[model samples]
Target: MTINPSTLVDLSHKLDSNVQIYPGDPLFSCTPHTTVAKDGYSVHTLTLGSHTGTHIDAPSHFFPDGQTIDQIPLSSLITPLVVVDLTSRELQDRQTITWSDIEGASEHMSPDVALVLRTGWSAFWGTPRYFSHPFLSRDAAAKIFDRGVRVLGVDTLSPDETSYDGVGGEQGFGVHEVILGGGGIIAENLNLGGLMNQNMIALVPLNLEGCDGSPVRAFAWKD
Candidate 1:
């Protein structure tokens, strides 16, 4: 089958020094190692956390012996995508995305398919409001895993509530613990706004050995 590259929808945020990062994480920096004029070639030295920008969290993110970024199968990163767009719901800051809110998607949840929660939070990417994105409840995450969903994606910093200045301090990181502890993979900070009729997706991360996570060049296309 012939597939046009243009038809693929980009689902990753562009990485730069200005990309909003999770609090306490390493800041992204790109410095020129060699300039074309001086060295006859251009090379850049990139410095950033494994989970910087659009990235996938391997099971190792939470479990000490779980699969690492390089251990995950490439085929698992590329699969049919099932999107649950919640932008129309007018989600509030630090709101909990309960199971009932996504119960309708139970039918599509599976190990072979990638489930993406589109909270439309990508719009606040560079501001403090970006950290106030809606998060999935631990019960909801458990339910998703119960359905054999090993891969999950979200258009936010995390599926769990972003804790800031004591806000969301009680919620903890239950969602992350549940998913990652279950040996599942999570793709975070995705740019799902451009997604329309696309079905399949590829979230290819770097093969960083023993790394808990890695940035991915995520994209999607219709079958």
Candidate 2:
């Protein structure tokens, strides 16, 4: 069934000067360039990291010769989605979403679908805990990539562990490399709280030439 436009649920986290971002990355800023009081119109200038809040990471993000953000096709941006809920049942000490969790989520999977992983991390948007939220284990990411999934959207800043290395700090981007290197893109920092049961999603990324990533305004449609 076709979903009504009015029923589209926004799956993007609102971006602002203080939206959670990767540490050491450029801070998001929006300053008034023109005010209605003076110019009869309002305009604001923005400064932000390419991979800022609610953004899509193109293949070029990790692979030097990968596709640029502008090269992402409309077909790739809009697709049927399978929201995989992994956090609702996890224990406090469990942070890595292993392959078993993914297997459980995909028992009735569809082909060529985008998988949106919800970790319940969106609830901590303004806190340090958000940065330390659950991540997809490398083994799990490898399975997803092998399945030919074109896009992986997440409610966390990364699918990779943000604070720890392999033994406690593995700098190698295992998830990013597997997904992007496979010609698959990733959408990060999503507001998936309302999308746990969603079956479709649309990602509209800014068409910036030669860009590696762009903040996207995402939405999910009903079943």
Candidate 3:
């Protein structure tokens, strides 16, 4: 007997206090204004960072001359995704994800496909341990850019490690510069582990004009 298509599993992580947010980034908060006991209505004022929770990074995030969230092409935001798991490394190892990693994980990466990296760091959400983890290296960023991939997603904070310091010299600006500079979009803080199938992933970002990035409601579906 086959199960109905509608009966398929739909796993989504709730955007709440339990969700781990990057340090120095805005936290999700809601201010209750009206309640049933007061004005017979319920309302709330929500506040959060543009990069809060699961979100998409516009080119402007890294390049001052790049396109903002509103200017991002819809074609690049939603498409087939290849899930690349890299959970073998320990936490905050500063290990860089190289181009070979991508090639080793998948056969071919199309120009329209979104690359989702699963670092298994999502488990450390809501704790100090979640702040730092293995990130993509500058070489990897160059490789993805060379391959013509416009969108990249990671299950961590930024593509750069937390220990990275942007001080003197060409410090702290490697992978992001290569990716965003190449006009690539980034989706950070995603929970891609819940999805079993790797068919297509839908990335929906809040349409905020002139904004570098915006919070997103990202999910994956398989038929």
Best by lDDT: 1
Task: Provide TM-scores for the models.
Answer: 0.97, 0.92, 0.85
Q: Is candidate 2 or candidate 3 better by TM-score?
A: 2
Q: Highest TM-score, which number? A: 1
Off by over 4 Å in 1: none
lDDT score at residue 219, model 3, on the 0-100 scale = 73
Could you tell me which residue pairs clash in candidate 2? 164-168, 164-169, 165-168, 165-169, 165-170, 166-170
lDDT of 2 by residue, 162-190 (tens): 76322333534788988899888899999
Per-candidate RMSD, Å: 1.1, 2.3, 3.7
Give the lowest summed-lDDT range of ten residues in model 2: 163-172
User: How does model 3 fare in lDDT?
Assistant: 0.73
Q: What is the lDDT of residue 28 in candidate 3?
A: 88
lDDT of 1 at 143: 97
Question: lDDT tens string, model 3, 1-223?
Answer: 2334552433234677666665567788877888878989999888888888778888898788899999987777768778877666444545666777667754555587888888887776666666656778778777777877778888777777765244222227587788788888888877755666646777878789999898777777664
- Each model's backbone clash number: 0, 6, 0
Q: Rank the candidates by TM-score, best first.
A: 1, 2, 3
Local distance difference test values of all predictions, in order: 0.92, 0.82, 0.73
